[model samples]
Target chain A: MANGSTLLVGIAQGIQRPSALQRMLPSATRRVLNVQLTELEHHGLVSKTIFAELPPRVEYELTDLGRSLLPVIEVMEQWGNTHRTALEQALAGNLAELPN
Target chain B: MANGSTLLVGIAQGIQRPSALQRMLPSATRRVLNVQLTELEHHGLVSKTIFAELPPRVEYELTDLGRSLLPVIEVMEQWGNTHRTALEQALAGNLAELPN
Candidate 1:
């Protein structure tokens, strides 16, 4: 996943709790996810709800606009998965036999 | 298109000439397009060819890896077109009534 799309995809896939979201993205530090989540919120893609209960429960849910992104995310994920190997090579400029 | 994908898309749609690619993305200056084309070449997504002819013809073409990105670009463009209004607002953080 690129940009905050991974976090948005995580939120869409029933992982709304912050801790759960963090676990979903093991590579990103908690602080990074927090920052990205904040950006996602600022972008109107997701909404956070805070409860007044003890411990202050908080969860993220996709807004209407955010939900609209799911289809786009779906195709992106599919393409990435399908092209993962070539993509890795492409990013590294490792592929050979191109014209000079 | 995002992250130089517009240029890739332009090339995919048969607009291979540098001048035509610049025309396709009018928002970006010629120099900006050149920079992005360099980046794309660096990333192994595109290849440049120069013809040793009278006018020194040059063109950009997607490598096999780059052509694979077409589906991803298609969906991204679709989503952007569909959400252009909200996305514009979101970028400016001008969204109203987003959770306080």
Candidate 2:
């Protein structure tokens, strides 16, 4: 769920359409989103529903299992935001200290 | 914190020594453990102390941040245990249904 957390969390927040998810995760490739969605579906964390229309539409929603993961992911997201700078500096420092 | 969670949680459970952590995470390589430990250290999730002995002994202890991550990881671990079979079956089924 590392790479997939952003997608999953966005879906949990009611953004189900792929376009919306793509907008939210600009760095994510279509293939990557597909693969993450497939993994989430496989893990029972999310469900995919296809709508029959002039153009087919696909939407994703969190299953109960997926909902359960949200709080953890939320907490992790908060932690990441809170410590992102420190983590960046630490890694930079570590890299700088590495032997030539 | 995904891969590092195992090591962090193990340390939170009073398993501090590297050798002991390695024992707990048998599948983890020493390099992986070192990287995780360094990241955790950088994140302020854990701290390392070295004992000057016949051979230097290293130990890790969780910071408040690291301790906070434990509950989330514990919940995730429980969910994984609970849904292991369903998840495995789902993936296998998905794979089986794929076109040749």
- Reference contacts preserved by each model: 0.50, 0.47
Q: Write the per-residue lDDT of candidate 1 for residues B12-57, one digit (tens) a residue.
A: 8899998999888888888888989988887778999999999999
A1-100: candidate 1 lDDT, tens digit per residue:
3757888888888889999998878888988888888888877899999999999998999988899998888887887798788767766654453466
Model 2 agreement with the true structure over A1-100: per-residue lDDT tens digits = 5667887888988999988888887788988888888888877788999999869999999988778777767777877787677677767766787789
DockQ of 2: 0.47
Backbone clashes in model 1: 0
Query: Scored by Cα lDDT, where does model 1 land?
Result: 0.83
Poorly placed runs, candidate 1 (over 4 Å): A1-3, A92-100, B1-3, B26-32, B53-57, B89-100
The CA lDDT of each predicted structure is: 0.83, 0.81
In terms of lDDT, model 2 sits at: 0.81
Question: How do all models score by TM-score?
Answer: 0.77, 0.80
